[model samples]
Target: MAIEPLAIGVCSWSLQVKNVAELKVFLDRLGIDVVQIACGDPHHAAWDEGDAMPAAARAAGFRMSGAMLGFPGEDYTTPQTIERTGGFGDPATRAERTERFKWALSRTKELGLADLMLHAGFIPAVGAPERKAFLDTLAQVSDLALRAGVTVAFETGQESSTLLRRTLDDLKCPNLKINFDPANMLLYDNDDPIQAIELLAPDIRSVHVKDANRPSTKGVWGEEVPLGRGQTDTRRFIQTLKKAGYRGPLCIEREAGTQSERFHDIEYGVHFLRECLAG
Candidate 1:
């Protein structure tokens, strides 16, 4: 099969800019036009004002690939902390999160976005009551997204691909999909990214082109390195993505490093990914 060229994009927040103008300056310098817009953080002042994500991306002359939402209180400081405080899996926060997701659905439509992405938290093991509840929460989110005529691509990494596949199958929601992050699998010790791309190919609607190492200690957070600098084999990773027929933006995400440091890494990463794609 002929390999499709993936759009070189980046998660807007990864640039850590103060505004869209700053982001545009950096994106222009980096030669990137696609952006996964950031939205739905109740804590974010710009998001709280609404319509900021799409407007900003448009003003910046970016192709808004999609929007990513984060719950108000997710603590990603450590694996254990996230298991307790991340995603919509927790019943204590599910109701509130559902409302937030519903708002996001409306905002997505208003912004004319095709879809949005979010972390659904750690899906409990099959047959666990926690699993059932988590599924229900996601189901509700799916309903809202579908009704709004958009997809919700759940981010990978907190759970195994097998379990994620099973959960999606169990729900049988058409609007739900995957934002495959290869680095996350290695970081979270969930599954190998190449293996996951094969397993979840049909459902992957977007991709994160970040790279990372496995956690130093199980249950601890892993170190996120610059692209091609970590264990995420870029050669096999992109090859598998092309072979699997995924046609989506390879959204670069750099969650670590200083502003200048991150910008420099992203610049190098864009070149590295393009070189890999060329071959």
Candidate 2:
């Protein structure tokens, strides 16, 4: 089978749009038809049409690369808060979150997409008391995805590539892959995104084309900037992706700015990626 050439696109939620109509408007403005859409979970990006979002998106005349799900009650105010509340990390929230994942899998099928992306939260260190439970929750979710015929791509950066890689090896779930986000490694102060690509390349199913600078203060969030404006080295990032054989859509995600600002930055990101890919 021939691999598809890499295409540049954007995350639907990054536009901060409230409905499929609004998303279409922005997609047209950006002149791109490919997107990784939100699953209309209240915590992520809820749509005005509510349960009808899937139908609306189907008729919206764009290509959906995948669907994204953010569990309810996830707080991103600080690294600490997110570590505690993100994904299947906390044993207390496993049952509820697993149900949410099931719903997302159905929604993904409705969207006619095979990939679902999400943050798996901060992974517990090897041999930690809570580690077993965390891995067990992930395995359950992976099993659900396999049955749904959907590939779940966990977003990177909640932990080191080493740990994430080990977790994947431990689970050995074929459907459980990775959604590579370069800026995330910087934001979380976890690892060098470039080096991480080499380690996690084989399992990379999608890519997020954003840029960021490492946090000056430990335990704080990094600074997200327009593409090509941060320490991510946009040019090298693209080059590395190609070398690593990741030929997926580059979805621009801007989570640190206002609605208007995010739009502007994403627009810039599209052009920036064009140059990188072209070069």
TM-score of each: 0.94, 0.97
How far is each candidate from the true structure, as Cα RMSD in Å? 2.8, 1.6
Report model 2's TM-score to 2 decimal places.
0.97
Q: Please list the C-alpha lDDT of all candidates, in the order they appear.
A: 0.83, 0.91
Candidate 2: Cα lDDT at 240: 93
Q: Give per-residue CA lDDT, model 1, range 194-253, as digits (tens).
A: 887877999999999999999878877788999988999987899889999988888899
Model 2 per-residue lDDT at 133: 84
| Number of the top lDDT candidate | 2
| Pairs with backbone N, CA or C atoms under 3 Å apart (clashes), candidate 1 | none
Q: After superposition, which runs of candidate 1 have C-alpha atoms over 4 Å from their true positions?
A: 1-5, 40-53
lDDT of 1 at 230: 92
How well does model 1 score by local distance difference test? 0.83
